[model samples]
Target chain A: MTNAERKRPGRPPGPSDTRDRILAVARELFARNGIDKTSIRAIAAQADVDPALVHHYFGTKTQLFAAAIHIPIDPMDVIGPLKKVPVEDIGRTLPSLLLPLWDSEAGKGFIATLRSLLAGNDPSLVRSFLQEVIAKEVGSRVDDPPGSGRLRVQFVASQLVGVVMARYILELEPFKSLPVEQIVDTIAPNLQRYLTGELPGLS
Target chain B: MTNAERKRPGRPPGPSDTRDRILAVARELFARNGIDKTSIRAIAAQADVDPALVHHYFGTKTQLFAAAIHIPIDPMDVIGPLKKVPVEDIGRTLPSLLLPLWDSEAGKGFIATLRSLLAGNDPSLVRSFLQEVIAKEVGSRVDDPPGSGRLRVQFVASQLVGVVMARYILELEPFKSLPVEQIVDTIAPNLQRYLTGELPGLS
Candidate 1:
């Protein structure tokens, strides 16, 4: 420890403490008002810190949101590569990218957080993430009929969320232990259909 | 009110009381020991009722389990029809039957029970229901290539469970509001693929 710190115990909040306060406030506001409606400045004010401090600690609002939710990596890490890929390949590529991440040690936290969130019967945070973030990013690209984009993405979300539940939360046999590649290959076609296939109700 | 009943204000347990006690006991035992091992006699014994009374009240072990889980209808209500459906059409037929039930008034109770169960983080009951009851009835029918039945059913379960999460729990827009028939049509093909379609690493 620095001599100055060693000499003075019981000091005021440090960098980590300030960062944690910002995250707690961000989670509350985001859950209450959703991502679009909740602002960094609002979160900063709630945390009793400067907006600049919030940004410096967590980068951007989305990044802050990720941190608040306990996702180990930025969503852009996955969404960025997805932008470059052909729409036809998104079904395969999306799961290919995500399955590995979800299977990693970091994924345990995400899964645990999801379970707790669902258990609490409050899904606003997750819903906001899906609607505002995922739907906007992937949904816009696959909006084949223009207005059908969000529904299509939501369908995709249904399947993906199911996979998470079955594989992680429910922990069903064989499905839980199956190779990730096998799952990616199997669901890719179905997910592709949701993304691009003709449907009964959609235009 | 019957005259005999009106004469007494809090008499000994009535027939409905006996039934409720049996159901509560059944849920605990079934959740702890699973369907194959938990017996109607055991549940009756725990409830301090006769095995005959348990049978008379709930009809069968599976029926008791259905009531215990608040499923409203006997699982046989779905499973019986499924037994008649050709394996080739199960994917479409399965969702066609389930979507309506899930969207029904009775389904609300089941969904609420599920939410509370999940929130409590004790999925043993749900897991048991899926593994022993649904998997046995459906998996056995789809067990193509010798031993692949259970796994196939589980994969299908992942998707179906995901649909429940999306529609009821997360209540994702559009996906949540989509017509029963629309969802049935959209997911049928995918579910059918899981049942009978060629999958990687399965052979």
Candidate 2:
């Protein structure tokens, strides 16, 4: 320990370090083991810590699961403004909103986690994540009627996911290497369709 | 066995039984392990037979993997009619078109594979499955302008997956139990929008 480190405070380490450690270990273990099979005690063991340490830190596995798999974006901050963005302008704004994240380090973590679920066999984890996170975070923001939000949100989610699969996961050649700006230009309008376009024949 | 049957049958369950047994074991194992990890030798050991038996029966692990996951639905049979559905009507017909099989035994295998993937952590599996199986099947049928056909196909896939995530995967309360017809009625128009719609502000 550095001479200054030993002199710091009453708790030794501040409260955040324990929580962060648990999440780091949880992500590794959950990736290795199926989510359903990953027990709290197992996560505790993986961390070389006590079960109480996990419970004290995360409370429940579901909550821990949520935290561990959290994407870097704070949905509230990004999406909240989207709801009020004159829904028409959303076509332009939505693509502009996601491009940087899709092209950045933090966004890659989100993409990796999303793509990982798409590649894994446990639909439960992906389903719940979509329901709890995607639905609540993205779907709930739009003021459309109850079910309308799902259609809008799901359509939007699919566009983003499809781009990820084609570009990152499947590594489709042109798209895989496309410059960030070009991709945004190409995909943004389609997303705009999902966000605010009208289907000619039906609605 | 009947006295005549036992005597008339080819040599008492010898090499023939081993081949069939190996195939059965291989099918189950491959379904569980995926093709990458399953080996001819593993199939032989699991079935308590010689490895050469696998070669005799299926020729290769790749062939065996294909056999294990093969479905009754002909890809053309699944996707062919959509070409006739007209892009406008494609949305309404989308769910009703496939939900029967998704509810069928044959469809269940595909669904099981899809469900397994949907449950997993990777988003790409669902994306690829949709692309490989559903999207390619449906999207190829929609002959629109460059981006529209692709976007239309992607939008269709998004709706179906969203429904599965809702009704099957997450088991969302009201949605989980809603009749298929109701779901079709509720969600199809949004799909219709993407299939044959004017870009909201573009038009």
Candidate 3:
């Protein structure tokens, strides 16, 4: 039957409906408390499902976070490889890993979610991911002058985010059509500088 | 009288109403037809006002476009300076001029308009401004390999746009709070590289 027919009153909530409810609750809690402070049990409780079921469906907290944000892949798929890369090489390695993913079909959902998140009142989810996840994972490694790593990653983030905007959103000609490697190679040095260079006020 | 009373139907349309109608028409035409193709007369005609009145209300087509986009300052205020700067200096010159303006009180409206524009279905107005206005102004100067100038400017746009996203929208700490000079100093070399650097595939 059609989705509308299925949604008529007295019908039991389908698995997809339950999953959507779980996702909605997960998004709310994750956005409010952030990835670090938010717990799987809390999301499960709010969704009225067992914690084990949440894990069974979405695997891990980070994975659930990814799904909540409509990112189809696990966060670790990229992060795991990143952990293996040396700090000095992260500049080049990052776009190399990410560009392909962002260029793929799944990337559309991510770009859409990002546009909506930025457009929405609460950018906390995006901020939380950048701060709690990306900063902690990559920023710690680039922390050459003790406490300057976060800012370094942030500068890198600005450029990377801009690339996303130009290529995907603004869809600037030639830029939108440029081969992925061209972009990666062009921005790599700049990203490297941000990660390891002697930036002003960073000492 | 209260704004509600002032907006009452019995009263004749105020100067503000006429100005707003022109701006709304300008925005619609600019978004659909782009800056180069759209004209003051067309916008004035659409708004049912005299073309001279449109010019009186807004100084020039570019100024009208700027107003349509909610940029409080005239577009020429920034573009006029860049016209004099040597190509080599543009990298440093741009952010030095822009960051302060973005940090100013008037920038709030521009940023809001930008957020809404990106969020909306038609990013055409932004695309038009970037392509027709910015690309024509700066891209022509940087066209070292003949046809590569536009792409170069687009890359620069990506980075600059990213800075706006990071500092203003994402509110990344330290990035958001960094002194304007610090940001300018940091991104200048990178911007210069994009402007004149030997980017891959650009030969």
Candidate 4:
């Protein structure tokens, strides 16, 4: 296809479905400033589009934000397959379930988001993220016991967040350079424990 | 003293320090965009001061960040006496040492900074912060032995971060209104265990 004929977003002057570009700018601005501080004007200026176009595309800032930061993976698509897997192996199944996805397209985007979140300069985005992503999903999965599940959930998050912190954010020596599989194998046991192990301090 | 009598940081017609004003603006910007993304220009514009004056007072972004974020408590001074205290009492001593610091003038700023961090706005700030203010000092005090202080250190941080996430960043219901000391006391044992306990599977 000729460059001109190739599908591309219609530029500013009037409305166009420029949600993707708007989202990109929003992510960058939000990463740079924060959700609260990054205004429509800034995003419009950065994206070289009209601000009203952003409203038309995404509706509200929160909706725009949800689109901007949304993990590409549908939670249903991810967790759906595991429903049939026995709860006992849910421990082992958990990491295995997640690894492939994280190794793929949607997961890679999520990983980048995690990396940005680790280093991004916005608080509201991060807080909302922790609740939306980690706390809700990870925190809710506990079946091990009472407090045990909670501890397990927190530990699971800690391990994962720590790993992301070390590997992605800090770029620690071996971890930074390690293959994803290697890191997974090394950390999966901890993941399983948090997922299925007897959580300590539980009655 | 009259406002005019207050020391101005920069030359007129260029930029002014506007210390208190800068601090106020800096807090909002920093909280919104994190330490790095929030720039001198932004702070200047917000404070109605010249950006050059920020350079005159703070010298560099790093220094400015330190001035803006560093809690006044010298970890060395506080941790020094902690070393001399009995091992078993370290848990109790820890909260006493750290809680007051978190509640102090500088500590409040630091906590506010942390609240922003927990919210996920500034990953670099959190990383360096954990490295500089938290990990190094905290790691030095705790060890891996029977009474080694380090295990609980991790727990303390985890617990504290969780509390900050829920209480400050997420602004979840009851947690928001809970007294700090009460909250600290409630979590102290868990912190103690995580700080000092033989975390299963790790050791």
Candidate 5:
């Protein structure tokens, strides 16, 4: 055995090692079979760890998924900052806050998570994350008509999801080549409309 | 062997059987490993056919991909009908014409194609489809600033892709539950704006 292997012989490979192994296995299984179909026991078996260890480390499957995907920031981090701005200004603020992340080094993980969601692995998790976390948080802060807040949040999610998929994931051009400022300038007003604008057909 | 198996045993299992088997294997591999990584030889090997047979049947990898995914309608069918309408009407006409395809029986193939694209299999195919096929065809029909038509088509593509992801794939609520007519009504004007309206920030 190598000196490094001999030194760590009886230590049970450390807590972080076990945690990392479980996460790696979970990510592979989730990517292959999707979030709904992969189970904790299966992940444990693949990782060669006890099932209880998986739960002990990650708490729930959803929590484990979040860990495996490495979602960089809380949705509220994006939504919370915008709450201080006037509702009218949020159109501009929304893209300003969110778009920078897509360009940053940290955004790669976010992109992977988004890609996995697009791949139809645990779509319910994405839906819940958007509705329960992002929409609920932002909706509580925004002053809109009763029950309209969720719809507004959904619209915002759709626009943002589309932009990321086009510009970052699919790399669809002119979008792929355009300066970020130009994209921000163009999309902000539309996002503003979705956030606060009236629906044309609905009362 | 059963009568059905006996009848098909000789003569290379007939044309349709060989073609269907090749396509099925290609779809599975493409979905699993993505387009760039999957090879014709590998697909043939998995399908239990000679490599030459795959080439003889499908002509090229691109053609095989097109056959496997089965994009339901020529994009021109969507673009062609809109051409008869005034250029100004194309925006509103677009969603009216194309969104219904998502909910149709044939749309299953489209959804699969989109999922594969989102999964990062042969993104170039989608890019070329959008640029060479959809944009080229649509741009020829629309009157816009010399270089801006491509950008407009891209914007429309982003919106349509996002809506389908949210409503069909991600199942974001409100969008998921709302009637399709309402979706068309709400989004048609925005698509129209992308199609013909003055972009907010561009000079």
Candidate 6:
């Protein structure tokens, strides 16, 4: 049978197409109901496919969410550049890699993803992304006193998230109006401190 | 007529009652649609009163928004304690005062109000409150090089907003679980730098 002759008009053309359709449906549901409340079965049901198909395409909910919000520049890709820098210089190198991406056109997707996270509907996803993805990746590279790496990563995340919220989302002026380079300069030292500085009051 | 006889069933009991009713309606509309989109006419109509009455009582839309989100403990009251501390100690004192309030029962109202602000429906209200109230009060006390005090105040606002978002709204771990005192200790120095330290980079 010829390719055109054998094709089903109503069905997605191929497996890749089917996967894309499932992802689109998943994105819509996740955005509306949040990641925690959105179930794979519900996504498959909404996508008009078998639940097994979702399981086949995306092995877990976290992977599915990562796919749904996937930008061209994967977060791993963003973090990859950090690996090249000396551990001590990671603080300075971190902002140079991150700030430009956020300022770029690609950052809009991230901004939206962040807004969804901050909407406080599904905190589990935010926690997972922070602890599992971000902390794991950044912490693995840095040598710290056992559990301190996670704390450092968390502080780093807090500062970065806060900057994004104020500068991009909230559009707080001075921050909003400042040149990107200036912002990088102003914030890099703070990020550095969070990454490696001593906790002044923690026992 | 006796006071009881003079009271009409449909009418508000007193001027203050009518004002309260209007404020309540304004709050609902602002929460639903945001401050910028919600009009005085809409608020008045929702409250079953005249637009002029809204204008008369609130004076302006900004004033009306300020009224709607007003917590029992004013921002001024929160800043009042900072006055007793030396300007150098303001950063430490500021969070010590604010975090306890947020951790208290009264902070619930502030949390709700903050959620409304973060919803991005009416940034003007957030900007006004930050600039006119917070910056003005804090700036008045801090002796900085000309124009830098506002910058300092804004930076302080950004940090506070970010901390509230992570700790309260997003509930990011460690930040969510950390004791208020630890958080104050951790963040106080950063606030101090923003408030008093030479800004590292600016044109």
RMSD of 4: 11.7
lDDT of 2 at B192: 72
* Model 5: lDDT of residue A73: 57
Better of 2 and 3 by TM-score: 3
lDDT of 1: 0.86
Per-residue alpha-carbon lDDT of candidate 2 for residues A1-203, written as tens digits (9 for 90 to 100): 44365356774655566566678788777656645668899998877789998998777676677567666555544666776777557656666777677778877766666644544434455555555555665566553554555555555554565565455554433446656665555555655655555522224
Per-residue alpha-carbon lDDT of candidate 4 for residues A62-126, written as tens digits (9 for 90 to 100): 55765676766445454556566665555556556665665566665665655444332444565
Worst 10 residues of 2 chain A by lDDT: A194-203
Off-target runs (Cα >4 Å) in candidate 4 are A1-67, A77-108, A111-167, A170-203, B1-69, B85-105, B111-141, B145-163, B172-203
Each model's DockQ score: 0.58, 0.08, 0.79, 0.06, 0.46, 0.37
Candidate 2's TM-score on the B chain: 0.58
Instruction: Give the per-residue lDDT digits (tens) of candidate 3, residues A66-113.
Output: 999989999899989999998889999999999999999989878988
**Best by DockQ, which number?**
3
Q: List the residue pairs that clash in candidate 5.
A: none
- The candidates, ranked best first by DockQ, are 3, 1, 5, 6, 2, 4
Ranking by lDDT: 3, 1, 5, 6, 2, 4
The per-residue C-alpha lDDT of model 3 at residue A122 equals 81
DockQ-based CAPRI category assigned to the predicted complex of candidate 2: incorrect
On TM-score, who's better, 2 or 5? Answer: 5
Per-residue lDDT, model 3, residue B13, is: 80
- Measured by TM-score, how close is model 5 to the native structure? 0.73
Per-candidate alpha-carbon RMSD to the true structure: 5.3, 10.7, 3.0, 11.7, 8.3, 7.7
Candidate 6 regions with alpha-carbon error over 4 angstroms: A1-17, A24-65, A70-72, A201-203, B1-17, B21-67
For A1-203, candidate 5 gives per-residue lDDT tens digits of: 33475358676677877787788888788767666678899999999999999999887776787777686655556766876898888878888877888888878888887777667676765666676656766766553666777887777777788888789877877788887787777777777777778875445
lDDT of 3 by residue, B1-203 (tens): 45686689889988988898898899999989999999898998999999999999898999999998889999889989998999999999999999999999998987897788668567888899999999999999999999988999999999999999999998988789889999999999999999999988889
List the global CA lDDT of all models: 0.86, 0.60, 0.91, 0.56, 0.76, 0.74
